[model samples]
Target: AQRVTQPEKLLSVFKGAPVELKCNYSYSGSPELFWYVQYSRQRLQLLLRHISRESIKGFTADLNKGETSFHLKKPFAQEEDSAMYYCAPPFYGGATNKLIFGTGTLLAVQP
Candidate 1:
């Protein structure tokens, strides 16, 4: 079973429009969440963490324990923001801690 789930495979929005990427997680303990972003032909980079309570490049997410969700939101979408976003949380089940990432959501910012 996947520890994280990204409901939308692709979220399309026009320039200047708001965007939201939905994510849901299943875990027994309090899990810190991270959002990863991958731009065209670039390596995946850490976009933000829920614990920081800060926005990165106009994106922000709050960890909701009750709902087990960490939804990424941006007030305005830019064409440069088009990329793949992932919801990842560390998996402590094994001897080595690893990130368990969702399938990922593609954000398409259209002009």
Candidate 2:
């Protein structure tokens, strides 16, 4: 089945360090990628989506179809950025659209 992969389970970095959250996907059609984030005790919410080509909270992800990847990146890390980050693609199942999310990578920003 088509899926998204987040290779790292935990990514720890000191404040001001550059951060990258890896995400790779496999799909047959033109895919829509999303980065979802869950802060501590908070619900998962959309961080960014590929089609809009937008950046959220100083983070950006570019779709590279040739590489089948949409890796999330930031120029620097901050304590507030600590959270669980998921890579996802919309799954068209029957009449409904569902999201298939990666196992998620926890970003820990150490001060």
Candidate 3:
């Protein structure tokens, strides 16, 4: 079975502080990993991808194959960064582009 797990439902932190959102997964085959974030009341957008090896919005994620984990990290948290973050894994082959999402972690960046 393919599944994604976000350990923390909420992560509260101060502005300029570091933030880390934990994510774990279970899949028999190779799967793509992505971090989708929603800032404040904004719609969910792609933050980063493990395959790209690039950072977006000051956030980066590393996919640990052995650990079956892909954790999102940012050195400095901005008040504007306060949002709901969801870690997801897309189904490789299907009729539609459907992505399985985690419960999500609400990041509160207090100023």
The global C-alpha lDDT for each of the candidates, from Candidate 1 onward, is 0.93, 0.96, 0.91
Q: Which candidate is the best by TM-score?
A: 2
Query: What lDDT does candidate 2 reach at residue 80?
Result: 100
lDDT of 3: 0.91
Task: Give the worst 10-residue stretch by lDDT in candidate 2.
Answer: 88-97
Between candidates 2 and 3, name the one with more favorable TM-score. Answer: 2
Could you tell me the C-alpha RMSD of candidate 1 in Å? 1.4
As for lDDT, the candidate ahead, 1 or 3, is 1
**Which parts of model 1 have CA positions greater than 4 angstroms off?**
93-96
Highest lDDT, which number?
Answer: 2
TM-score of each: 0.93, 0.97, 0.93
Clashing pairs in 1: none
For residues 1-110, write the lDDT of model 3, one tens digit per residue: 77899999999999999999999999877768989988876788998889999988889999888999999999999998889999998886667657899999999999
lDDT of 2 by residue, 19-108 (tens): 999999989989999999999999999999999988899999999999999999999999999999999899888998799999999999
In model 2, the number of clashes is 0
**Per-residue lDDT for 48 in model 1?**
95
Q: Please give the TM-score that candidate 1 achieves against the real structure.
A: 0.93
The lDDT ranking, best first, is 2, 1, 3
